[model samples]
Target: MTVVSSVKDLEALTLTIVNEFDAGVDRVWQLWEDPRQLERWWGPPTWPATFTDFDFTVGGEARYHMTGPEGEKAHGWWRFLAIGRPASLEIEDGFADANGEPDLSQPSGRMRVSVEDLGGGRTRMTIASHNDTVEQLQELIEMGMEEGMKEALGQIDAMLAE
Candidate 1:
């Protein structure tokens, strides 16, 4: 997501996050698309994530079971849309059970990710997710999406640095 602010109204806001990692584009891409590598940085670093039946591609699905700080389990899935190796990927995210069947009505919306080489063995990663309506955006906010993503991305950055 790129950050944009409305000059007309200070209350109108948009999220724009730009992060560069100390890793090559291909390496970062591989880490993102691979289930095993994803496990290393999919959720909060302290909690760790476990994946099941992960397939990264158009029409493919991925299931991740994350253990919370209190040891509670929650599962989620991603339905792939576009996949361009070492460049970009688009997908839909949602909550799911152990079987990877998502509730279509309560999804997290479509997310588009772009990866670019930033020279010096660095890769820039950008992610944007647009909900279907303002209601959904509010729902996402209630669900703590922003905080979760910050934690997730923070873990990713740590993995890339390592």
Candidate 2:
């Protein structure tokens, strides 16, 4: 129940998910800093993610796969563009091929993750996904990106609780 709200702005070609956690910024930031913690909530409940490789530097790359209930796997990769540490991160996120290489045939997006200290051991986290074009945004939406993101983010509360 960490998610406060989710908004999809078609006109701006962005999808933003806002969440609040009853933990300090540094503690909440571990959700991204630690790959194991990330794997626990990076995907929807029905599709659990496993990070095969992770590097958190500004120019680092993270490769992962989400396995569906039916045993199907969806590959993804994130190339970090900026890392502000316990506060914000920006990356180019894209679908990947079986070999974990970026699949240009699939639309990619820029994702910005921001963590704000709400004080009193509380933190506000925001994930903003920006697509390059209207068509690309529509395509992601058609793929249930909104719902998937919501479900994925909803798992964060349990992680924080742990």
Candidate 3:
């Protein structure tokens, strides 16, 4: 088990934001590491997600395909850099085309997730995403990534609170 007694304070860099969810650290970690659980809460409410090849471990890889409301398909992958059990996770994440090949022109990012158990059955999950540049951050903003994450995490809260 990862020691989540310490809270991590992160500076907001290019497109960095911290979201706190009121759930146990272990519960939050389960929502993160389990592909089925992620698919339940990780996509837009209009479009359901289906995941393939998900392995949550250091050096492991995951691939996900989400069908948009307009019937368009989006794919992505993450190369896990670190997996701190129920406490933290770090990974290099990127988007790919339908065939599962990297699109170099798309912005890639490094994401670090710190799970701090706040006791009383709550956990503050902070996500720090480092993009290549400010331009990349702006691009992601234009792509509605922030709102998407917010909505997904909101769904996570709803699901976990059950």
Candidate 4:
């Protein structure tokens, strides 16, 4: 219910999801700045993420895996491109193998996360996932990235409450 809008811009080959939170910008920022905190809601309830390596600096990278209900693991990686504390970040996101090698078979994207102070303790977080081609964007959507993201973000409200 915290989501404000989720739009897919086919022309731009991007899927943009916007979320609004009742908490302060700082509180929301911590969700991404802290690896442990990020693990709390980075995946859907059915698949919880565990971070193996986290280097949250510009040019640094993070490696994580999401464990499903049946204990299946989905590996992923992120290379930070730009980071603006409590405000914005840009990263190259891709699927990886257990050994941390990129999975070239899957489509990768550049994800931009922006946090805006909407005043009066309200904050807005926008995530834009961009792929190089329309087919790549469509492929990711077919893989349930949008729904997975929605389900993943839905948990944040309770996290902020705590």
Q: Pick by TM-score: which candidate is best? A: 2
Tens digit per residue, CA lDDT, model 1, 88-150:
988887767646567566746677778899799877887666565666566445334435676
Per-candidate local distance difference test: 0.70, 0.84, 0.73, 0.83
What residue runs in model 4 are displaced by over 4 Å at the alpha carbon? 104-107, 133-162
Off by over 4 Å in 2: 133-162
> What are the per-model C-alpha RMSD values against the true structure?
9.1, 8.5, 9.2, 8.5
So what's the TM-score on candidate 3? 0.71
TM-score for each of the candidates:
0.68, 0.79, 0.71, 0.78
What's the true lDDT of residue 62 in model 2?
A: 92
CA shift at 159, candidate 3, in angstroms?
37
TM-score of 1: 0.68
Candidate 4 per-residue lDDT over residues 1-162, each given as its tens digit: 899899988777788999999999999999988999998887766677788989989999999888766677777888999999989999998878877777888777899999999999999999998888766555444333445565567788668888
Model 4 residue pairs with clashes: none
Candidate 2 positional error at 129, Å: 1.2
After superposition, which runs of candidate 3 have C-alpha atoms over 4 Å from their true positions? 1-13, 104-107, 133-162
Instruction: Please provide the root mean square deviation of candidate 4 (C-alpha atoms, Å).
Output: 8.5
- lDDT assessment of candidate 4: 0.83
What would the per-residue lDDT of candidate 3 be over residues 1-162, giving only the tens digit for each residue? Answer: 233243333343434455566678898999888889988877756556677888877898888777765677777778899999888899887777779776678878898888888889877877777776667566444333444676788999999999
Rank order (by TM-score, best first): 2, 4, 3, 1
What lDDT is reached at residue 41 by model 1?
69
